[model samples]
Target: MTALPIHPDQRTPSDTSVPVSESFVSIQGEGKLTGVPSWFLRLAGCNLRCRWCDTPYASWEPESVSRPVDELCEEMRATGLRHAVLTGGEPMIFPQLLPLTERLHRMGVHITIETAGTVTRPGVRCHLMSLSPKLANSTPVGDPRDPSGKWAERHEHRRLNFASLNELIAGSPDRQIKFVVTGPDDLPEIESVLARVDGWKPDDIILMPEGVTVPDPDEVAWVVEACRTRGWRYGDRLHIRLFGDTKGT
Candidate 1:
């Protein structure tokens, strides 16, 4: 990660590389800077496979084709929005995202990233980072070629990235930690993970209820109280509330 100095006059490069699914301008629907107008750069790839993921369209499937970094920056510029959010199945899956983020920052756009926190890239000064680590309950799609024991071993290796990422975020001031809480069945595991990440503070950690398909008030209440009792924050599923699991909003 080169520490490229951000300058307003930096020219958009002519090189056409990297893939982008779509870029749109919309108010951030979740996390610390909620309701803020932000140009969303939805990159198209992910390493972790969460069972309750809503963006399966952007996960493994080939969506709309790739566009160069400069062209994507141009689309964000056209939005006339000063803030941008780079989100995806996992934005950090691509290192090119760091350069793109640097270019956007040079253009004077405040950048935020909503990621699964299983991957990290250098040189991106995220104004805010929302990191959600995948838990054991969310298993990757199993391949028959690999035995169950082998699958478990591989899964542990992949999921360890989340812990490394969480460690990095512990000292980052602009970063927030979030976990998708499903049920009481998941609470003990969530607590264990939280205990492992010593950097996570109660105020900086949030619990977001899973299953946006239907609003689960019971789960929501449980999360709210757990946050309250534990001195953590409770994050609302704003997009679900706004559009009810609709895509491309």
Candidate 2:
């Protein structure tokens, strides 16, 4: 499945492009579309540095190779897959994504954008807007991943943009809001944030346990109970379990 949707890859510098991390055909491991077969386009570069970001290859040190969107579209057409996931270190950061998503959608591909909900691009179309809003737990404060404590400060400042978050939710009816929950303490912050954001029902929210490896039984039970009590959905990273966090799954 080289034909599956993925970040653009270019042959020449003249080609219009976005930095590509990788691409793969895999079951969606998280969010509302969990267990769905989907092609993933992992674009590189992220504005925020989360302490537990699984794909540091795509975020902390993104691929330097800029890939052509036109080439990617050609491959996508050949894949014969209806679902195309435009994921990234943060796909919304690339304006080139407008054309990329437009072409894929026009090809009759059901586009699903996996974004952190910090950025928004108007005029983009997708069947599903899988918004994984970074919570306070994502801040890299004092985490060894950011040894200099540089990204720690910057990540905290850029993690949440309510203006963009609201726009993403308000613009799409077929969208899911997800938050990675680290512990029971994260519950109150989620409640407070949702109260401020516009246009989402309790059912629209999804609470995901934070881990790449199989989470402990206690964590799973806690998240399930949290969802049961709050009218939210529980999200799991099935791909991680199925593929062991490896690339091109």
TM-score of each: 0.84, 0.90
Runs of candidate 2 with Cα error greater than 4 angstroms are 1-14
lDDT of 1 by residue, 26-116 (tens): 6777777878888887877777655556787676463756788888888888888888888887887776775687778779888778887
Q: Using lDDT as the measure, which candidate wins?
A: 2
Q: In candidate 2, what are the lDDT values of residues 86-160, reduced to their tens digit?
A: 887899998787778767866888888888989977767677778887888888888877889999899888888
Provide the lowest-lDDT 10-residue window in model 1: 1-10
Q: Global lDDT of each model?
A: 0.70, 0.81
